[model samples]
Target: MSKARTVRFHEYGGPEVLRLEDVEVGQPGPGEVLLRIEAIGLNRAEALFRGGHYIERARSFPARLGLEASGVVEALGDGVDGLAAGQAVSVVPSFSQNDHGVYAERAIVPASSLVPRPEGLGAVEGAAVWMPYVTAYGGLVEVGGMRAGDTVVLTGASSSVGLAAIRTAHRIGAAPLATTRTRAKRDALLKAGAAEVIVTDEEDVAERVRDLTAGRGADLVFDGVAGPGLTDLVRSVAPGGTVLLYGAVSGLPTPYPGFDLGMPAVSLRTYTMPETTRDPERLRRARAFVESGLRTGFFEPAVDRTFTLDEIVAAHRAMEAGHQVGKIVVTVPH
Candidate 1:
């Protein structure tokens, strides 16, 4: 048995409810691996899970709460192959947080959920890369069949996933039109490889999209903010184009615009990370695609800031503040 400092919340509330406590960790059972954590990646889904707003609620009190992390393999369980102890690895968000969370000094996760960390990638980058890049690749490349010369509009363009989407679009020889609520992030978005930045508050999203696409509208609209504004985003889609609703940071109920707006030949679909991560074949393809992009310099993990494990509360606060331009990482000291 080992003692690990773990983060858990006994109740559903704000970041204030998160508590760091010492817990006993046992040896990895069959098909599991023990990891000495180095860094943890933060996602909005974890925040939602912490606050009881996620699709899956806390199964019990003192619930665990993390999805991705980078670490070194401490030990491997029976029946695990192709991975040796002392190897650098990263945890993919393939399992439920309620079953195996990574916000700790050490954790035991399924061997199938482990990915070998690349040679040049550090712990922080490894932790940051999988969630955003895989999400972007899964949604745009795998699901949407995005190809060269396509026009993709990325909502919440300053986010880590949004930045990854821009890079993925570029990788496929497509043009990425990034959308933010204001001009504060326009230059940054452009610098991050967005072909164009559209300020939602300053201009009509659909009109700007149409204008940018030479009156054709976008071939794909990758939306992380789903709410009443979905109607306008749907309008921004070209005929036979697709609108992929992936996240709900808007915190409001989304309404279907197809019936009310009578948009013809437009398709709207919902996406989540599990759509790719849960399937072994899909995850293998996604991992290969993202790894190739990283190797060729087409994809870079954007980290907005870093915090210590003890400051988990502050990290959550910063995430809720919504000013970050990239991924929020938490470093664990051994």
Candidate 2:
């Protein structure tokens, strides 16, 4: 066993509850591999999980807190093949944090969750890439069947996943309409490849979408902030289109829009990153799609800030501040 510094929370509360401690890390077990972590990615889900608002509650005290990271293989367990020691890799969000979290100097993770880091991608980019891109690809391409010339409405357009969806839509010849609660991020969203930006606070979302789509409505609506506003997003969808709900940042109860509200013949579905990462075939496709975009310079991960592992509490504070326009990453110094 080796000593490693890890982040843990003993109680459900704010970032103040987090504690960094030294712990023993044992060898990888069957179907697992030991990784020397280089960087850790921050997600709103991690913040939600830390605050006990996530779908999956912590199974035990001193619960771990992370799902994404970039590292190098230190050792491989039995039955784990096709990977070698010293190979650079990125961890996918296929497993629960309760089972394997990545916020540490080293960690034991399932071999199936490993993906070879793309060429020329540094630890920070590797750590930041998978979750957002996979979520966007799975929702817009795989599930929604987004096509060329399609109009996609991306709510919470300032988020990492929302920005990724914008680029992914452009990659597929689709036009992305980005939405933000305020105009503070309007120009940044446009510069990030959004065809248009709609300020939810100043404009009627449905009217803006209709005007942008020439009254046909959007072909797909990718929403991360689900709440009362979902009704307007539902009304913004074209007939036969879909409204994919991926996150609940609003922290409010989302009621299904009744048919009497003139809601179109649309499908409302929810998505999580694990839906794509957990399936081998789906994960394979998602990796290829994202890597290709990266190689061609079509997809560039927008990192809003970086922090040292010791500043985990501050990082979570930044995440909850809800003002960042991109991914937040934490570097694990060896």
Top candidate when judged by lDDT against the true structure: 1
What would the per-residue lDDT of candidate 2 be over residues 138-226, giving only the tens digit for each residue?
Answer: 99998889999999999998998999999999999999999999989999999998999999999999999999888999999999999
Runs with alpha carbons beyond 4 Å of true place in candidate 1: none
Estimated TM-score for each candidate: 0.98, 0.98
Q: The CA-based lDDT of model 1 is what? A: 0.94
Model 1, span 1-334: residue lDDT tens:
7799999999999999999999998999999999999999999999999999998999999899999999999999999999999999989898998899999999999999889998899999999999999899999998998999999999998999999999999999999999999899999999999999999989999999999988999999899999998999989989999999999999998999998887568889999988999988999999999889888877888999999999999999999999999999999998
Off by over 4 Å in 2: none
Q: Which pairs clash in model 1?
A: none
